[model samples]
Target: MNAPDASDDPTPLALPRVPRLRVACAMQSDTGCVRQHNEDAVGCMIPRDDDPLALAGALAVVADGMGGHAAGEVASHIALRSMLHVYYASAGPPPQALAAALVAANDAICERAGADPACKGMGTTCSVVAIVDDRAYVAHVGDSRIYLLRGTAFRQLTQDDSVVARMVRDGLLTEAEARRHPERHVLVRVLGTKEFRPAVAPRGMPLQHGDLLVLCTDGITDQIDDATLASVVRSHAPVDACTKLVELAREAGGADNATVAICSLQAEPLAAQPDPSIRTTRETRAH
Candidate 1:
C-alpha cells in the first residue's frame, strides 16, 4: 500500500523530542517441555531517525498462531509486518494510526491464508502496545495480554476476547474453572481467518515515570495468577522479569507456545502529559 500524505501538526509527528527510550526484548518459543516446533512469535519496533516519535514511544507485539505444520508462524509474521507498514506510512494521530494498522493487518493475513492451501485454516492471536510520549496505545484480539507495573502495583491493561474469557465474564464459569476448562485455548476471533474484523479499542492512557509495560501470550498467563505475575514484574528488570515469568510457567507446566515483550518508562526530556494506562488495572467480576 502507498504511504499517507504528510501534514503539519507542529507537535512532533516524525519524532518525539523526548530522550530516546530503549527496550530489551526476547522470545523463546521452546515447544515448551513438549511438541516438535514452536508456533509463537513476538517482536518490538522502535521508530527510526525518520520516525523519531516511534522512538519516543515504542511498539511491542506478541502473536500466537494455531494450525498444522509451520503455518502458524507464517500467519503471525504477516500480521505483524502488515501493522508496522501501515502505522509507519500513515503518520497520523496515535489512536487513528493504531486502528488503521489493525485493519490493514487483518486484511493482509486473510489474503495470505486464501493464497496458500497449506495455510488454509491458519489464524493467530495478536496483542500490541504502542508507547508514544507518556501514553501506551493498545490494540488486541484473542487472549494475548498487556500488563502495566507501577511501583509495587501491577495490572493487566487489555481484555481477553476468547470463548473462555467471555464465559468467565458472563458468570457461566468461575475464574479457576475457566483456567482448567478443556477448551480454555479456544479463541473466538483471530487474524488470518475468513471475514474477520476485531473491535479496536482506543490507544491506552500514557505511562508515568518508573512504569513498566509487558505483552505476552496465554502460555504464561495460564499457569500463573495475576498476583504472582505482578510480584515478579515489580521486582526484576524487564528482560530478567520476563525470563523469570516464563520459568514460572514452565514449572507450572507450560502447555503451549509462549512469548513476551517488555518496556520500562522513565522521565522524558521533552514535554509530557497525563497518561491513562497509568491508572490501575480495571476488573469486571461476574455474578
Candidate 2:
C-alpha cells in the first residue's frame, strides 16, 4: 500500500499541558484625598502557559514617583513599564532577571529625565516581587515595601532605604520613633537618581502554602498599620482586600497617592512539584 498522504489529516496537534505556580492577585491605586496627580504605578506579568518564563516565574511591581508637576507620574510609568519589558524578555533564574529589570527601569528613567528638562529631578521608589514555585524573589529601593503574611505572623520583608529606616537599623531610632520621625519621608536610594547600584539577590526566598504577599507604597502603609492590613487580607479575597485597603487609607485622610498589590499562593501538592531546586548558601536578601 502507498504511504498515507500527510495532507489527508487536517486535525491540529494538541499542545501538552503545562504545570503552573498558582497565584491569585489584586491591586489598587488612587490619587488619594490630596494629590492631584497619581504618581504611583503598578504592573505585573504572569507568564503565558506556553512561554518559557511560565515555569521560571511571574513578576509584580509598585513604584512611587517623586517630582514636581507631572514629572513624578512620568518617572513611575517609565520605571514600571520598562521593568515589565526587561523582565519578561530576559533569561537565567527569576532572581537574576528581577535585578536586571530594575537596572533597565533605572536606565530608562535616567534617559527620560535627561531628555526632558521638566522631569530633571524625577525619581521613584520601586519594589518588586517575583514568584517562582515555592520561592519569592524581591527587588526593592526607596521606601516602598513588601510584606509577607504566613500563618499567624505578618512582617515586612523589604527594608526601607530611607534616612529614618537607616537610623532604625543602626539602633539610633526605634521602630515607633522612625514611624513618627520628622524625616521618615527622606529616601536615600531611588531610581532615576543616577546613583543606583542594583544589587543582585541570589536565588529566592522560601515560601509556603497559604502565604500572602503585599507590595505597596507609603500611602497605604502610612495610613494602615501592619496588623490592620493583615486582618483585611485575612478576612477577604485579594480583590476585595485591595479595595478595602484603599478605602481604609482614604478614610484615614490619606494625603498622597496610594497603591497596593497582593498575591496569594495556594497549596502545592508534593506530586506536582518538580525536581528539588538548589538553595543558595551565603545568599543575602537585599532591597
Candidate 3:
C-alpha cells in the first residue's frame, strides 16, 4: 500500500562501469653516424594505475636541438624536462595543459640560453602528443612532427614550421624540390627563441582501437620517406617499429640525431567475476 522509494531501485546498481583505454608505448633515440653528440631528446609520461590527478593520462615528446656543440644537447634536454614538469604540475584539460607546458618549456629554454653565453643562440624543435580517454592532443614547434597511422592509411598530424615547408605550402616550391632545397633544414619557428609560439591542435584527434601515433624529430623524417615510413610501421610491432625506424634512418646515412616514439592504443576490457550463487543452465545446439 506504500509508494515505492526511488532510492531503492536496483537498475542503477546493475549498470557496468566504463573501462579505461590502454596505450602501449616505445621510444628510441640515437646520436646517429654524423652527429658527435645526441642532440635529440625523447620521453613519455604514463600515469600510474592509482594516480590521483588523472589529468596526466599519457604524454610523449620528441625534441631536436640545434646550435652546435653541447649547447644543442642541453637545449633539448631542457625542453623535454621543463615540458614534462609543467604539464604534470598544472591543472585543467589535456590540450590546455599541454599548450601551457610547451610555453613554460620555451620560456625555460630562453632563460637558460640567455644566462649562458655559449647557449645564447641555442634552440630546439619539439613535438608532443597527449592522449586522454579516446582522443589525442598535439603541440608542436619547428620541424619536429607528430603522425597518426590507422589501419592501412597514414597521415601527418602536425605541419612543419620550416622555411622549406612554408615555401611548399605557398606553392613557391614542390615537395620534391623542397626536400632537396639548401635551406630545407632551416627552421622558421623553434623553442628557446624570443618569438617562439607553439602550434597547438585545435581539437583532439579521435582515437580508435589499433591506432598508432608517432612522434619524432626531423632526423627520422629527413632520412625516411612517408611511404617507406608507413610500410615500416605497419610491418613491425610497437617496439620494433621504433627500433627499425631509427635503424632505417641510420642506414640512410644518419645525417642527424634520430629519435622516435611510438604509441599504440587499445581498448581495455572490463573484468567481471562469476557469481557462484547464480544458477545457470547449458544447452547444446544441433548443427
Candidate 4:
C-alpha cells in the first residue's frame, strides 16, 4: 500500500530483447514452505501478429486454483483452456476478448463442478492480461494480481477481490493488519461459482518501452513484500526475476502455491513496424 520508492525497485540490471516484442516468462510452484501437492497453474501464448489462424498474443493467464481433493488443478486447467478458446474465436479489442474468455471460462468451471459431485465447490482465481497492438488489457478475480513497472516506478493495477480486501475497501481493516489477519486467505470471488460474475472488464493501458507487466497468484504476493517484489523485478532478467521471486516467497515461508509470469514490452525494432501496405489492426484508441 505504500507508493513505490527508490527502495522498492531492485537495483536496475541489463535485460536484452528478442527479435519481436519479447515476453519472457518463467514460473515455479513449490509444495511450498509446506504442502502435499501444488495447486497453481500458468499459461502463456505469443500469437503471430499477422496470421489470422494464430491464437498467439491473444491471451496469457496465471491461475491459482483452490479446492479439496485435487480439484484445484482441474479447475485451473479447465479455466485456462476455455479462456484461450474463447479469446481466439472472438474478435475486437484485447479487453473485450479477455472479458468474454473469462466469463466463458467461469461458465465452463461451473458446469464441470455441477456434473461431478466430488468436485463440488471447486474454484480458481484467474488473472489474465491480453496484449494487442502494443497495449495490454487486464481482467482478474480473487486475490491474484497484475503489476506494472515503468521506468523506475512500480505499481499494482488490479484490486484483490477477497475478504481481507473487502475489509480494506470498507475501511474496517488496514493493509498491514489484513496481511496478518487469520482469515486473510478467504476469497470473495473466483471461477466456478454458481453466481460467478468475475471482474472481467477490459482495462487498457498504453504500452511503453521497457514496461514490465507481472500477473501472479496470491502465493507470490502473500509471501514477498511489494518493495522486495519490485526490487527483484528491476534487478534481473525476466526469467531470473521470476526465479528470484519464487525463491523470495519460499524464503518468506511460502504457505501456498507460488507462481509468477514476467512480461516486458521492449521498444519495437525500427524494422519491425507494420508496413503501410497492410491495413492497420487497431483495437482501440490510445488513452
TM-score to native of every candidate shown: 0.81, 0.85, 0.89, 0.84
Best by TM-score: 3
Taking the candidates one at a time, how many backbone clashes does each contain? 10, 0, 0, 3
The TM-score, computed over Cα atoms with residue i paired to residue i, of candidate 3 is 0.89
Positional deviation of 29 in candidate 1, in angstroms? 4.3
Residues 242-278, candidate 1: write the lDDT tens digits: 7888888888887776677778776744435334324
lDDT of 3: 0.87
Clashing pairs in 3: none
lDDT per residue as tens, model 4, 1-287: 97779766776543443334545455555657876767888887776656783543646788888888688888988888987788888876666777778889989888888899877888998888887656678888888899999878999988988898899999999999999999998988899887776565545677777889988888899898888899999999888998888888888888888889888787668577655444456588787
User: Which of the predicted structures, 2 or 3, would earn the higher TM-score when compared with the native?
Assistant: 3
Clashing pairs in 1: 15-52, 15-53, 16-53, 57-131, 134-207, 135-206, 205-276, 205-277, 206-275, 206-276
Q: Write the per-residue lDDT of candidate 3 for residues 1-287, one digit (tens) a residue.
A: 99999799855444445555788899999989998999999999888767965557888989998887999899899989988888888887787788888889889889988999999899998889888888899888889888899999999999999999999999999999998999998888888878776667778888988899999888899999999999988999989999999999999999999999999998776565334345579899999
Candidate 3, residue 226: lDDT = 95
In candidate 4 the C-alpha lDDT for residue 59 amounts to 62
- Model 4: what TM-score? 0.84
Q: So what's the TM-score on candidate 1? A: 0.81
Give each model's whole-structure lDDT: 0.76, 0.87, 0.87, 0.80
Winner by lDDT between candidate 3 and candidate 1: 3
Candidate 3: worst-modelled 10 consecutive residues by lDDT: 270-279
* TM-score of candidate 2 versus the correct structure, residues matched by position: 0.85
